[model samples]
Target: MKEYVLLLFLALCSAKPFSRPSYMTLKNMMLEDMEDSDDDDDDDDDDNTLFPTRTPANPFFPFDMLPTCPFGCQCYSRVVHCSDLGLTSVPSNIPLDTRMVDLQNNKIKEIKENDFKGLTSLYGLILNNNKLTKIHPKAFLTTKKLRRLYLSHNQLSEIPLNLPKSLAELRIHDNKVKKIHKNTFKGMDALHVLEMSANPLDNNGIETGAFEGMTVFHIRIAEAKLTSIPKELPSTLLELHLDYNKISNVEQEDFKRYKDLQRLGLGNNRITDIENGSLSSLPRIREIHLENNKLKKIPSGLQELKYLQIIFLHSNSITKVGVNDFCPAVPKMKKSLYSAISLFNNPVKYWEVQPATFRCILSRMSVQLGNFRK
Candidate 1:
């Protein structure tokens, strides 16, 4: 029986086995896989669509979410806005890279040193409408990039000391500033716009040469108690607003230094007389606002204003308007109604300048000529 079984297996091995399908053969599958691998080798690494290397997921770290802003302040990107927050003091936890900080309309009573010590990147600071009574000398010394500072509507009695020299605009309007001591803004040569209006600045508070070398473009000391024009105003000033003061007269030397003055606002004052040739010093002067004053006659030397465009002498006690006062500008005035020589509401003779409306007290009455006829 064993021999018979061995003979049968030998016979089956020797005989041609039933032909297996090519798909069911292991060698055929291995050959197909090799062909696919050879085809993949032709592709470049960039064209390969392999999964990207994954970074280990890090859990949240508190330092990554930095607490750079104060508790109640709203910080967006790099600006911190704490206005109208009733904050009595500056939050010391401000970010070092903060660019603009608006702390206006708050109850901040004082600004001490180190309140903004390390903030070197700060540019604009708005502290307007605060109850700031005092500011330490070095309060803003470290902020070297500070440019625009608004301290309007504060209770400050004097100009804050040690202000950043890089400031381009400084406004302290509507404050209780009693005096402007000598060298108050000594090194602020870069200052451009300065507005100290509506302050109770003393008559002699502005020291001589207080604004000696500054290239200030705009200066406003209006609504103060100045009896006379402050001596030695910066000659670089373009627009000077000194209206609403106690100035009784204007001397020739009062404006001798400002040759480039454009707009002069001396209205709402007690100006009774302006020295002869006072307007001549300002050769480039365009507009002179002497309205609501006590002038008896127009200031002499208006003919020298080659660039004079407007002279607002309305609501004054002027009794006369000299022909020479505006004759030099009449030629240009005829071409354009914008060059107004408004002498409205003055007690001057209406018929002197024929065809001009002078009896109209309800409106600003102006002298009429060919161009001014109404």
Candidate 2:
């Protein structure tokens, strides 16, 4: 019986070309390469745990009644791969013990309430590149353990309601989401990463208390229609990318609450000026990306950030590089030296800039200053 099961497992493995190796495949490969010795008993015990044996006392018991893989999908261990299958709806035959399901690149339109009825152990769901426009409020009620969800490149205009509170990452990029209600993320205390870029989100669309209950650390709202920074973001954010927007200026109070921010991206916008002390609010910022804007000079407060390493200021209208623009006059106060400072494509004359301007830079190559042709 053990040999029969081994043969069946190998046959299933070789039946398809998997895009990526599943956990079971890697484990089995490692087992095969290990030297056979006195540890064979331990290996056999592990194998039995993975593929259990039928009880000899009840020989007529239906041992093969376990839930099988969906018709056109591949199932191995606790993962189900149904991506790129042109599936119009969720498959009903998914095993009860499935931990992850890949249904990306499908034609599925909407998720019905019972689509994932009994999947209590489900941990992740990938539904990217689908035609999903609506999802039933209780569609994910059974998947309480779900942690990661990918709904990018869908037709949804708003976030799905009643999402599993256990979700840690939610990617809804390239959607039509315009408005965000206050209770959109109410019970999601475990959420940390949110990627909602490439949406048509309005500046006032994010209602107050939109992120009140969450402690999200990373948020990317790039390529949106925001005219000004939304003040409704959680203060626990570490990385905030707002590139490719219509924002015109960075007010002093724009980031007053984000004191723990480490990286801020404002590239490819219409920003013409940054208030004198605006960037100083984020005392712990390590990187700032403000390239491809209409700024005429370096944004102030760069000299106050001791941990700042990279500053992308290229493709701007800056006309000069002051000696104290990036580095503080006192070297002992800087906790980290500048690694990369880009100022290319700006109107600043590189020859007129003194060599002492970049004295605190790690290397000469770290400062990019040429290519200012009009």
Candidate 3:
């Protein structure tokens, strides 16, 4: 038995030892096994499987497939923020699917024709606080879907031609724009809000029928050189702000065409007198801002407005507040009570004014008075 055991041990030692398969051979075997398993599982319900139908080519997943963001800019989803980078021009690599591009506070001087090309999905473009002096006529031809455009605080001398007809809101305030051509806003039927304040615009600078094609509701031409309200303005205006202008008086016909105007702002102007029936046409007016002007007395037609709620007449030369200045004797005729009446810094004597003068106001605190300093 010992001799037999010794011989078996020697035979085992001399024979080739059992070894593990090589890595490639084991990998091939595993692949074959997976293929056989997949073939067998193909008959089973795919929804009940433990693994996916196919593996994704990218290991980092969905983010790796997104369009590349521009350098020195931040992009997320469909909005690209490229503000305050001192960029000389619009970045060329803006994604095709971008919805909004904020390029404000840059040094960009001009917008070439192809600057915003191929961005059909774009909705808003903010070029505020830039040095933009010129925009190519066809610069916005491709961005037909753009709605809100902010070009404020720039050096633009005129409204850019070929603006997107789908535009709804346009802010070109604090620019060098002096003139508005007749066809500047042509075909822009969707435009509603236009802010062109702090420009050098005068009445003559606006050509006839300049605003004929648009149905804009809110227009702000404040801090400009306008001496009188432009008659060429659209009659569809709901809010008209000409504050900080050189307007001397409110004529009877100044607001006749603006019968739909709800809010009127003529504050910080040179207005000394308002005609007797100047505000009678604005039956729907809710607020009137006439502060910081040279008016001698309250305008005549306030009591007739049934919906007038707020009136700002502070910092004027008015010395009296009549009991009927703001409200009619029959209070039931007025649809809305005065919410605010500002008369401070005028020469009016507070004690002399009767308490009944503010009977139509909602609250006594809403009536501001008695802070006159010569």
Candidate 4:
């Protein structure tokens, strides 16, 4: 009876791959290479389709001490997530049906083409915090179904030519990258979030159409050594993070096409002068962070920003005063627009127009506001 069941199991395995290496088999196989890697296959190993009974040589030990697979590995199931492992080499013989592979915090030196070949069902591939020097052409060529690819905190000097077309989120933060290839993310039609923060993308942060296919919510280039905003971005980005960059100047034309941008973080830089019409066209802007830099004068037409909610202008050398500077207005603006304004630490000590800033700050407050004399 047992032999019949074993035969049926073996037949099933040959017809389709096993869901995964059974726990007992993984414990035994991962410890040592299978003895059946030889010429003639052993029928006994096949008979015990799930696991062969191992005599208790030593008491059961935790499964953590197994031989470490090299980097660029493919763990087949949710059971094999790679997090914070200090591995240095790409492992061989990865499980083919891996759904989510966390290659985060490993010392993977290279990413060759088709490195993830067998992992056809890969969903999330995290390559964060690795010593990755280069990603070979077609490294993720066939990984068509990938949702998120996190390659942050690595030493990637160059940009990937063609990221996966099916990718939704890509986070490549804090690296030694300078420029993004014009065709960097060329054919990627469905890309949404691109977080390239804290890299030394030196003057040419991202080339025109660098984000060719993204029609998503945000595009953050914060903390990257850039002096100004990249003019050529997707027409639909809602939140733009150009904060902590080396931006010293911004005119109205620079932000003309960004009509859809809502949250703009241009704080922590050297933007002292705001042209009269600099933020005139951005009506949809809600939260604007222009704090911690230099600003002597802000525009009056900025009051046209009807959706302006939060304005953060702290630690700036702003010495000018105007109601529109803090609370940019919109057409037929409701009393419920501007919510919070934090200019708590500005250079001007006495404020004749302090109450208006308070009004803009409390714009979003649903409760009745306390009136402070200007």
Candidate that would win on TM-score: 2
Give per-residue CA lDDT, model 2, range 111-168, as digits (tens).
9999999999999999999999999999999999999999999999999999999999
Weakest 10 consecutive residues of candidate 3 by summed lDDT: 56-65
Q: Which stretches of candidate 3 lie over 4 Å from their true place?
A: 1-65
How many pairs of residues collide in each model?
Answer: 2, 0, 0, 13
* Model 2 worst lDDT window (10 residues): 54-63
Q: Rank the candidates by lDDT, best first.
A: 3, 2, 1, 4
Runs off by more than 4 Å, candidate 1: 1-67, 329-338, 355-374
**Lowest-scoring 10 consecutive residues by lDDT in candidate 1?**
365-374
Compared with the true structure, what per-residue lDDT tens digits does model 1 show for residues 31-52?
A: 5654654465465454332332
**Pairs with backbone N, CA or C atoms under 3 Å apart (clashes), candidate 2:** none
lDDT winner between candidates 1 and 4 = 1
Residue-by-residue lDDT tens digits, candidate 4, 1-374: 99999999998888955585456865776445335432213544454433435443434444564334435443432324657667665545455656677767778988887678866677888888898989887777778788888889999887676677888898999988888877687776678888989888856656777667657677888897788767778878888898888888887787788888888999898887777787867878878888877876554565667767677766666555665555545435534455666554566543355555545444345212222223
What TM-score does model 2 achieve against the real structure?
A: 0.85
Which candidate ranks first by lDDT, i.e. highest?
3
Model 3: lDDT equals: 0.91
User: Estimated TM-score per prediction?
Assistant: 0.76, 0.85, 0.83, 0.73
User: Per TM-score, what order, best first?
Assistant: 2, 3, 1, 4
Residue 86 lDDT in model 2?
A: 94
Candidate 1, after superposition: displacement of residue 309 in Å? 1.0
